[model samples]
Target: MTIQEIVDKILAYHPDIGDRRTCDVIVGADPNRECTGILISIAPTVPIIRKAIEIGANFIFVHEPTFFSGYDDECEWLEGNDVYEEKLALLVDNGITVYRDHDHIHAHRPDGIFHYMMKHLGWLEYLKPQARGWEVVLPPTRLGDLIAHVKERMGLEHIRYIGDPDAIVS
Candidate 1:
């Protein structure tokens, strides 16, 4: 598939929310070019771009901005910056098409990040689908135990909560 075809598929699946068309765009390279491989990532940093080139992937579906700015036309700050130019050059020279999927991915009914987290933590069975996203009404348990459960399940070493350790959460 070409980059444009992949982008069209994403839009068909997720669409765009209301007036927020800030994301879901091809930020770099020629979208019509056929893709060799696709790399999906949360960020399109220089290292990630280089890694994509190394892996022979010509399409990068990034969840964040390719350029330094969120606003497309606000790249004046990046003008003449060596790092910015180098990154742009890499994408152009390597024929890498960079598409940003920030808003649409989150706006999708299931919420991609939430779905992944729930599935990864074995909590999908407890998921309660809502208009916005999935929510789980966990049973009452001590805050400390809840924290521990989250830490263990999420593979997190540190967690912060806004309640007493002894407090029960429903």
Candidate 2:
């Protein structure tokens, strides 16, 4: 399928997006290009772009900005920057298309990121729905243990917390 078709499919999954302005957009390459393969990632780093090129994938759907700005599409300030120029050149030269799906993914039912995070952390069963946002209710455990569990489950090397490690949490 074409890049635009794939993007439309993704947007269709989030009907609530409506006509709202979103950060989700094609940040590089041609949307009309036929997709050889697809790569989904948290960000479009140099390594990620290289991987896409190596894998013969022309379409990259990312959860974050391609450029280092809040809005990935705006690059007037990044024109002379070496890193930005290099990254942009890599995308353009390699014909790699990048689409940022931040806002719509967050607007998804059950919230795409949170739902997947809870699932990956094995906390889906403990999820408690609230009026504003959801919460996870875990069994009483020491703060240290909870931190360790989160780090392991999320494959994070280290995390910073403000509370006493020995304090019990639920």
Candidate 3:
């Protein structure tokens, strides 16, 4: 399928849900170009782009921006910079098309990122979906223990918590 078709399908599947606008856009290549394969990534770094090319993938659906900024605007100061040129060249040379999926993914039903994380970390059973994130009432556990549980479950090496350690969450 063509990159345009993929973009259309993706937008249809996860259309702008609320007041937020989607950042999804074909950042590189012609939308009509036929796709060899697709790559999904949180961020399309130089290495990721290279790997995609090596694997014959021409389309990337990224969660973040291809350019340095959040809005994916080209940095003016970096126009003549080597890093920017190399990164841009890599995508252009390989005929890769990048589409950012940030806004829609976050606005998705049950919140895509949160739901995925909770499901993967075995915390789905405890998730009580709120407006933005899950809300849960624990069984009178200490704050430190609760934090430790989350850290261990999420495979986090470090975490920063707000509020008192001895304070009850629920």
Candidate 4:
């Protein structure tokens, strides 16, 4: 199906009781809306947008705004206080329409992003308490080894740790 059609169907499935703005982050199609590929993601960050382009996904169906609003998606008096105006400009220049699916993905069976991500991590079951992220049954691992392993696995440039980096977690 086309992008517009998908967006409409997404809005029609808002599960929240008082959820009014289900279209908060619904972006758009390509310039001609004839994109060869589609990419669904949690947000339209500059990195993710660039990745979409690199992966040949001309259409980006994001769950969040391309530009950060500083506040929690409310572009009120804090409208122009975003630090991502440049990213917005890039989207326009690249003919990318970014929409938020914050509710759309979450409204999926269980967590959309979480479920999507879980597949890669090989997690069959998860203890997903609301507010808290996840508790997967992982093999025993050392903190340092796990941290280093993760850093290498994701190819991250830098990682920040808050807890005692040396202290081990069982």
Scored by TM-score, the top model is 2
On lDDT, the candidate that comes out on top is 2
lDDT of 3: 0.79
Q: Write the per-residue lDDT of candidate 4 for residues 110-168, one digit (tens) a residue.
A: 56776766665445454445533455655556677667765775667678876766656
| Candidate 1 Cα errors over 4 Å, as ranges | 16-20, 128-131, 142-170
Lowest summed-lDDT stretch of 10 residues in model 2? 127-136
Deviation in angstroms for 34 in model 4?
3.9
Q: Which residue pairs in candidate 2 collide?
A: none
TM per prediction? 0.77, 0.91, 0.77, 0.59
lDDT score at residue 118, model 1, on the 0-100 scale? 76
Candidate 1 vs 4: which has more lDDT? 1
Candidate 3 local Cα displacement, residue 73, angstroms: 3.6
Tens-digit lDDT track of model 1 for 1-170: 78899889888887557775575577668999898999988888989999998999999988788887776436778889998888888988899988887777787668887878777777777776553575677678899998898899878999978989999986
Q: Please state every model's RMSD to the true fold in angstroms.
A: 3.0, 1.6, 3.3, 4.8
The window of 10 residues in a row where model 3 has the poorest summed lDDT is 129-138
Find the number of clashing residue pairs for candidate 3: 0
> Would you list the rank order by TM-score, best first?
2, 1, 3, 4
List pairs with backbone clashes in candidate 4. Answer: 25-99, 25-100, 26-99, 26-100, 27-98, 27-99, 63-101
Per-residue CA lDDT of model 2 for 65-117, tens digit only, reads 99887687778999999999999899989999999988887876678888888
